[model samples]
Target chain A: MTEHTLAEHTLTATDLRLAYDRREVVHGLSVAVPPGKMTMIVGPNACGKSTLLRGLARLLAPVGGTVELDGRDISTIPGREVATVLGILPQSPAAPEGITVADLVGRGRYPHQGWFRRWTAQDDAAVNEALTATDTIELAARPVAELSGGQRQRVWIAMALAQRTDLLLLDEPTTYLDVAHQVEVLDLLVDLNVTSGTTIVVVLHDLNLACRYADHLIAMRDGAILAEGAPADVVTTDVIERVFGMRSRIIPDPLSGTPMVVPESRHRMENSA
Target chain B: MTAHAVVAGVRRRARLTTLVLAVLAAALLLLALSVGTAVVSLPDVLSTLAGQGSRATDYIVLERRLPRAMTALLVGAAFGLSGAVLQSLLGNPLASPDVIGISAGAGASAVTAIVVFGAAGPPVALAALLGALLTAALMYVLAWRDGVTGYRLVLVGIGLAAILLSVTSYFMTRSQVTSAQDALVWLTGSLNESGLDELVPLAIALTILVPATAISARALDLLAFGDDTASGLGVEVRRTRLALLVCAVALAGTATAAAGPIAFVALLSAPIGRRLARDGGPALLPSALTGAVIVAAADFAAQHAPGLPQVPVGVLTGAIGAPYLLFLLARMNRGGHGG
Candidate 1:
């Protein structure tokens, strides 16, 4: 479980053009994921942040450019080979009915198991460690359908963890959760990154949480990068307003010392005026 | 519970359910082989199956009943496995071959051969198989956009099924009475006319297809996660889907060629197998065994059920399975998980 370090692979997309049925979602995008760091992509809806992540994760074939993993073209590599080094948790994956948490997590071992090489102790160990890491060992026997939204999300994370990959990508992992559960999910991801040094990439909707948690932050708008750097450096009032089309005030977080955006709503601005 | 223990428990349960279904299928096979006009005893049937019984018993058990029973078992297993693969691949309980029109396509074509072309026996079976394969190809071509999605495939399949059913009705209405009667019996799915000629092709198909399905079972399971997650997990989503679709079409086609689309065996087997196995994964083996048992038992009842005239096995299955489909629809409607 502890054999692989997450810093070995470099994930980069070079001038990628991604489209869904001729309508380009991401146009001429180039980005390098910082190795061994937690990077969060934040942007308004339909801004193509998720599309870029999908391109980087090799879920979508780029129409124009290439995505490289460890200096190799990702499209040229065998899928299972790529899977061993990278894992992604897509948003809103539907659980098969009556699937136990343990069984669902075990499916993450798919890439590792060959036709002749059936399940082994190593696979069990990976699944067990993933379940234990996510604090879902107790729910192993329970059906995923019966789990609450937070528990279900943790189980999904545990599944991605069970893949035992160096790089992990998640698209809005905290969506549909309440504030507390959102924090819990983010903290769990942070713990995973810190403990295993797994390169973590997330597309998040919450600006404050993204600012607080990301080691590197990227802001996207209209299918292009607006700004990317450390949260303290890139998450300014001007960048926030430009990316989100909203007026906002930037302040340092009291607890984390990260830049926090405080949106200035029309009612609040009028009241102050 | 520990993950290891939980996995072990699920596996144990699935294996136990499969074993139980296997035993039931075996017993039903024996009943199907022995109970007929002669009503051979179990001992006689066993000895005849072992090739040591009297000539009379041998002729009854080995020659006539064996082919029929084998057809029921093989066709049921094929439909079961095919249904399990399609349902898991599509991630929808409603996406069985029967519902999605693969069987209807075969039925329509077979009926056309009988009514319009005056075909009989092997030629009709060949026509059915061709129809099934063509319908599957058509469904895939129509469903494909960026790639085939489960919902789109099912929708296209349902539409095709309706069109094929109308074609079959048109043929039936235009045919001579006796030929139409034969086509109707075949459409309702019967094991009465089974012989080595029909069973051999289906047997050959299963020998190739069943193993192929087993090899792709893992990929099929991953596909239930939707295309994005499945591809992200390293599954070649399009290739895997195409492979599984081919295997499923072949299985359904061969079974239809043998016994004319056995209604609902393909549809009911997977869900029942899943429930009996008490596991989340595709219960392929259990579903196959469950299908064998259902068809064999239904064949037995169709022959021996007191006070009822000898009807085709499909009539009984359609009677039993149609209500279940209604029940499923009601459940889906109430739950709003229509897909």
Candidate 2:
């Protein structure tokens, strides 16, 4: 695994349970995400990984427990107050029709404005900073719909960054992107964490990339944590087979030396079974 | 140039466009006031406005023309702002008061008041307000089964509006021809001269409602970002939406009650405002002003049209607005896929 360091605020949970339409999605789950670190929550489809992320982001209310953002109950805080501290970028945020990149990014400053307040120099600076940080400065005035998948994803990241919150939660930010674009977004997230000390909590499906890039890895199965710790210490062949319910060959990533999982499919499964 | 200079330039350009539109609207209002069938000259119109004209000029100006002009201004601005706000909020260009049922609701209720109680003496405005509010409330409840999706709300509103419209037609068929003729103006969205007494209240209502809406323009900008994002950005999504809806209903309802469903003011003004503003930003204030200009101008045109008996200002607006609505629909269909 690559060398990594954990940063400080304690994002903790207690007896956190989540449900939809009276059916439980996430069981009693508890975990602490240290501040200023990249934590990736990973699992297969229907494993409640996204549900858990939504619960943590306060988009989904917990059925039985509370998520604590620095010791205070998150739900108890005013919505805007919570927004000022934490920003969540949901998967597939619907863009308003005919909206431009600059206008869309400017919306991220909503929490900072008042009824009478026009966009200030500070707001512009933050918007420009976000655009440059995500390398979308050149496309600032272009309509968001015209951007490629990768560029659009970057524009969304720029929007979230414009919020300027301490903690950023992204649910499958890399979805619908090509592998190259996926790496670019992940690298951008890594750069944000490393440079600005913004705590990044991401829900990613790719186990190998999760292991390679995340400072902390959280492997979940059936809405409960199967493993959580430093990636090198937590990701292993046994953890993969047990948590993922698959037979896999765990090898080092060719570039990063992080543990890479090569799933044994139907052809290989015949001999193993 | 610095970034501030760039932003300033954009703002100044927008301001200039607004100023030009304002001048055009004012010229239209003056022309509307002066050049009617009575054909009062500009000097006579000016003297009448200053309250110092011949008795005949005074009667034409104060008794007939002034009330109609003022009604047009109020109704137009109200319609335009409401349409713009609704369109932006729902992210649909077709989401005008009539299409979404606000005016239909008002029309239906006014017809009911006339048919059932034979309600007279300004009761139409009250009935219209009640109907409009009820429809808005119904639409709100139906669209909120989960969260208010823009498409769901518009669809529900259109359906509800259609139902109210059929009920209105049914009532018309059953009523006496004289009653039907009386109701016809309100039903088709007319501006009869009798509703002038409703003007003071309408003006007062606009004064309160328009400013309140202007204050929430920023929140509306956030709301157009979609509910979750808007909420995440510190907007109380439900509350802000409710507030805006209240303002829109009150503005449209009051104006409709006073002028009997003045057509296209709410539907056409906001979009026209958006185009005139030209920055493509949500042009709330300018939309309101444009609405006023359109209503005033249409009323003028109705009074001045030669070889035809004067139609309700509503008739002329409908004649104009219906085509624009159809044009928009045709344009949408040609695109093969649209909202």
Each prediction's DockQ against the real complex: 0.71, 0.36
Model 1 stretches with alpha carbons more than 4 Å out: A269-273
Say what the interface RMSD of candidate 2 is.
2.8
Taken in order, the candidates have interface RMSDs of 1.3, 2.8
TM-score of 1: 0.96
Q: Which stretch of 10 consecutive residues in model 1 chain A shows the poorest summed lDDT?
A: A264-273
Candidates in order have lDDT scores of: 0.91, 0.81
Native-referenced TM-scores of chain A, all candidate models: 0.97, 0.93
Model 1 chain B weakest 10-residue run by lDDT: B224-233
Error of 2 at A261 (Å): 1.5
Q: Can you write out model 2's per-residue Cα lDDT over B248-290, one digit (the tens) per residue?
A: 8888898888887887778888878887665446788788888
- In order, what fnat does every candidate score? 0.81, 0.36
